[model samples]
Target: MIVKFFKNSGGGSANATMNYLLGKENDREGARLLSGDPELTKRLSDSLNFQNRYTVGVLSFEEVNLPDDDKRAIMESFESSLLAGLDKDQYNMTWIEHTDKERLELNFVIANVELTTGKRLQPYFDRVDRPLVENWKQVTNHEYGLTDPHDPDKAQAVKTLNRQNLPKEVQQLKAQI
Candidate 1:
C-alpha cells in the first residue's frame, strides 16, 4: 500500500474538507464513511487553535482487489502501527472508502488535537517519523505482496516510460524526439 499525506489548510478547512470527503460537493458515488463522525471530528479540531486543524492522508492499495472486511482489517492495522503512541480516545480519525478507481483507497482525516487535554497530536513528523513510517510501509508491502513504492521499476510511470500515459501534446513531443 502506498501512503500519501495532504496538508490541512486551517482550522475552518475541516468543514469543507469533510464535505468534500463525504461527497457533499459533487454528489460522488462510492464515497462512504467507514468510521468516525465528521461533525464531531470538526468540533474536536476547532476546539484547539492550531495552524493545521487536521491531517489528511490516503492509503492506496496496488490494484489487488480485496474484500471490504480485509480492507478494514488492513486499515485498522495501519492505524495501530502508525499511531501507536496516541491512545484511541486521544485522537479522532474519520475513515472514508472510495472504490471508483482500480485500486482501493482508504482516505482518513485525523484531528490534530488531543481529546483529553486539547493538545496537538501530529502522527507523522518528517525528520523524526520518516524511518518508522517507511519501515512500516516496506514491511506491510512485503507481508501482503503489494507493490513496493520504494522500487522505481515497479512504478507505473517507469513501467510505461514510452510516454503512452502522457497527454497527446507530450506524447507527440516524445515521438518527435
Candidate 2:
C-alpha cells in the first residue's frame, strides 16, 4: 500500500476536525473519539475549549490498489500500528475512512495533546510514522501471502508487478484502438 502523511495541523479544535473528517466541517454533529479516555465524555466540547492545543495527523493510503475487503482490513492494521508506533499514551484520536476519492484514504486525527509535556509531536509524526506504517504493511501483506511494494529490497514485489497488470484482452483492445 502507498502511504502518505499530510502535514499535521494545529490550532484547530476537535469539533472542527470531526466536521472535516466527516466531509462536514461545519456540521453540528461534531467529532467523536473512537477510543481512548472513555471517561472524557466531552472530548468534542472540551476540545473546542482547547483550540490552540489540539493537533491533527492525516495519513492517506492509496496506490496499493488492493480490493475493498483488503483495504478495510489494512485500515484496522494501520490504526493499531500507529498507536503502538507512537509508544505514547498522549493522544486522543478519531479515524475517518474515505473511499469517496479515487483511492481509499484514511484520515487519522490526533486531536488532543498535553501541553505540559512540553514536547513537540511533529518530529515523532515525521520520523517514526512511516517506518511504523511500513512495518505494518510488511506484516499484514505477509499474512495474506502478498509482498509489500514498500519493503526494502522490493525484489519480490518487482517480480510480481509484471504479472499484476492490465488484462491481456485490455492490452489487445488498446492496440486495436
Highest-scoring model, lDDT: 1
lDDT of 1 by residue, 43-81 (tens): 777766787878888888875477778777778887888
Candidate 2 local Cα displacement, residue 144, angstroms: 4.9
User: Superposing all C-alpha atoms, what RMSD in Å does each candidate have to the true structure?
Assistant: 5.5, 10.2
- Pairs of colliding residues, candidate 2: none
- What is the Cα-based lDDT of residue 131 in candidate 1? 81
Per-model lDDT: 0.77, 0.51
Q: Cα lDDT for residue 43, model 2?
A: 66
What would the per-residue lDDT of candidate 2 be over residues 54-124, giving only the tens digit for each residue?
44554344443457576557656665576554544554555555555655455565544533363433423
TM-score against truth, every candidate: 0.78, 0.48
